[model samples]
Target: MSRAKRKIEHIHHALEHDRDYYNHFDDIDIVHQSLAKLNFDELSLSVEAGELKLSSPLFINAMTGGGGERTEQINGEIALAASETGIGMAVGSQMSALKDPAERNSYEIVRKNNPDGIIFANVGSEASVSQANEAIEMIEADGLQIHVNTLQELIMPEGDRNFKTRMENIQRIVEGVSQPVIVKEVGFGMSKESVECLWNLGVRYVDIGGRGGTNFSKVENLRREKPFSSFENWGIPTPISVLEAKSIHKDLHIIASGGIRHGVDGVKAMVLGGEAFGMAGTLLRVLLQDGRQALISEVEHILHEVKMALMLMNARSTKELHRQPYVLSGKTREWQEQRM
Candidate 1:
């Protein structure tokens, strides 16, 4: 199938197969402060994720683009929502656009709609330095995200099998690109070793795209002639991934993604040492099912809830979330103990 058709199919399967699986954020509980001096109105949501400063810690993670007009509309809507909400947005992989100039507009619509918003360009880890630069230039992105999806590629019949050079490619991209390079996972969360490797390669930002959100393995299985349901529940959970990334280094910026459902989950991620939290499946579902306005309202509601969570935690800003007390219990704590 063509890349455009595959892109649409991926979206369709993702929306149809969307499930409310547990992401382990529930395993985290922030200890409440009764005599907190901080007022609710005084809490600030502003956060710095590496060099990029965001008005809110929440961002619209990498989703769709480069399919066709449908994808262009989706990207535009998402960009507008992100702009309206004062959050960052990352376009889906731009390899299709880089390969075909006609598809460039699909991804370009993101920057066209939200010209001043913090936009991120994305490509798979296989992309060469020139190709990565082309993707960044195509969208005028503030940063570039090189996503690694070994399990997803293995499940997808048409996906690439050669991933040996992904690390080398990422290192080259980091050195070649002037913008910040973010090494991201696609539903298969990063290990501490993976985080350390990226950190050693001069990568400062890492988006631990953990499981519990959109399962690309399941999506690919649905497209396969012979389905593999066994691989659907693979990879580390979002909360666990956050812990793993943080365990590597305190200076390493972690963008907690995967199955972040709401603002509470976002707050939990920050408290666990994530610089910011990203939502792709949740925001994409809202945009598709409800409409652009609904998506905007959803983002606003999430941002409001983040502020409320900070107020309840006796924190003045997202940076202060680490100073607040939190308890990790259940499977998440076990994972932390074993892994970290």
Candidate 2:
């Protein structure tokens, strides 16, 4: 099948699948405070990342693009939702658009819809300076997310073979591009070492796209001649990945993802070290199944739930949530200890 056809298939499989290794959520807990002096309306979660000033810490993450009519329609709907909600959003890999100019409108629809909201342009880690620049220009991107998907590529039958140029590509992009380049994981999660490397390379933003979200291994395996079932459950949990990234650098802005299905997970992610939370699967489901109005309602509900979580802990902001006392247990804690 063509890559564009494969892209749509990937989305279908992601929606109808459940391949999470275990309950990573079981590993994280935020201590609730008995007293909260402020009202829910007083919660100020204004997140300033790169040049984007979001109303809240939640953003619709990168997914779907580079196909024909159906892909564009999906992106258009997702963009409209983002525009209405006033949250940051990202378009999936623009490589298809770059290669085939006909697909540009599919990704560009995001910018056309969300003119003012924070929109991130995305590309693989192997993208050159020109490709990255073109992607950002294509969307008038507020920021650029260079996703590292080594494991996903390994599972993909037609994926790139030589993967040694990622660091060099990232370094060049960061140095050459005026927009802030964020190094992100494609669901496998980011490690301390990798985060530290990005920090040293002048890349200030990182998205720890941990496991427990969409399983790309499963998505890709279904397309291959033979499935690699054993690798399906690979990678660190989302919260653990956030802890690991935070351990490497205090100043790097961390965006948490990977199985962040609801507001409660977003709250826990903030406590664990996420400055901003990105929800892909859950938000996608809501938008696709229930339509735009329902998607808006769901986002509003999720944000409200996150605010309640903040009030429960008396966290006036996500920064405060990060400072709040929290405990890690179960397999997450054990893995953390072993890593230490």
Q: Compared with the true structure, what per-residue lDDT tens digits does model 2 show for residues 109-144?
A: 888887888899999988899999999999999889
Question: Candidate 1: where are CA atoms >4 Å away?
Answer: 18-20
Candidate 1: lDDT over CA atoms? Answer: 0.90
Where model 2 places Cα greater than 4 Å from the true spot, the runs are 50-52
lDDT of 1 by residue, 31-70 (tens): 9877777878878999876688889899999999889999
How many clashing pairs in candidate 2? Answer: 1
Look at candidate 1 and tell me the lDDT of residue 332.
96
Give each model a TM-score: 0.98, 0.97
lDDT (0 to 1) per candidate: 0.90, 0.87
Worst 10 residues of 1 by lDDT: 15-24
Error of 1 at 216 (Å): 0.5
